[model samples]
Target: MTVALMWEARAVAGRGEELLAWVRAQDLAVRPLRRETFRAPQDRVLVITWWDAPYDADLPELPDPDGELVTRTVHRWRFEPVAEG
Candidate 1:
């Protein structure tokens, strides 16, 4: 089953653009089938990656940017599609 990984982070104060650049420059160890990134109010950044592996598979996740760039710890979630059968 394909799995989707979601990663999110909020930048400190007025460092939203900096945080976004850092996230854009990151290189994943394992390339996903599909990947996308977005930004929202409150200096937040979100990234979603779809992989062709099991939900519990060990996949290389984007490392956290420098602490100074973020306000708090990064958040992550994993999900798999429900089978119709």
Candidate 2:
């Protein structure tokens, strides 16, 4: 099965660039099948990593950034593909 882990965070005012850079620099203990990052107008950063594993399997995920860098705790989710084009 394939699992997708999503990690999202909102940076403090005017620190979007630093937050994006920090996300890009993070390293996982094991590389995923694929990974991607995105940013939005609200200074929110999103990272999605695809892995080959069971839905309940333990996996590596991005850790929380320094408290001073963000506005609130990070949000995360896990998903499995149910359809495709």
lDDT by residue (1-85, candidate 1, tens digit) is: 8999999999998888989899999999878999999999999999999999987999989998888889999999999999799
Q: Each candidate's TM vs. the true structure?
A: 0.93, 0.96
Against the true structure, candidate 2 reaches a TM-score of: 0.96
Number of the top candidate by TM-score?
A: 2
What overall lDDT goes with each candidate model? Answer: 0.93, 0.98
Off by over 4 Å in 2: none
Residue 76 lDDT in model 2?
A: 98
lDDT per residue as tens, model 2, 1-85: 9999999999999999999999999999999999999999889999999999999999999999999999999999999999866
